[model samples]
Target: MSPLPLHAVAIGDGLTDPATQVLTKPQQAFAFGLVDEKQLAQAQALAQEAHDLALAQRYADAADKRSAMEDLVPLGARNLPEA
Candidate 1:
């Protein structure tokens, strides 16, 4: 079958491409035929990649929020107000 990108094809065994590594996990898997998806189109696979990326961002955001509330950051010197 012809490749989706039309230019990212890798021939022969034991060969690798830097371009492939740059692709998202789903994209790489789909491109390399790691998963059976005869009914799945490349566009749909790309959409799945988008979905996964969005989900990853959510996890990262949660981690960021937790870090913000944690004592991981060092507090600088300050003065106390008179009581």
Candidate 2:
């Protein structure tokens, strides 16, 4: 018995170049799978770094706003108008 022509099989530690072939749909799929895996990993790492930076900036901004509000509180003339 032999493997079917269109059957999907896993390559085990093979030295196949994923982006060098375009013969069948399965080959294209395999290439895209490799590219997508790499792209997704990179995107995930970038997202995590962006999220950390955003969180740090937000915290710093909140602290600055709090300090500004505290300084204004001592003036007593910046109170809200009566409603």
How well is each residue in 27-74 modelled by candidate 2, as lDDT tens digits? 232244532554444433433443444456654544343334323222
Q: What lDDT, from 0 to 1, does candidate 2 have? A: 0.36
Q: Which model scores highest in TM-score?
A: 2
lDDT of 1 at 79: 15
Stretches of model 1 off by over 4 angstroms after superposition: 1-23, 38-57, 60-83
- lDDT (Cα, tens digit) per residue for candidate 1, span 1-83: 88576657655432143223222333333444543354224424443444444456654544343333222222331111111
- Alpha carbon deviation, residue 63, candidate 1 (Å): 10
TM-score to true structure, per model? 0.22, 0.28
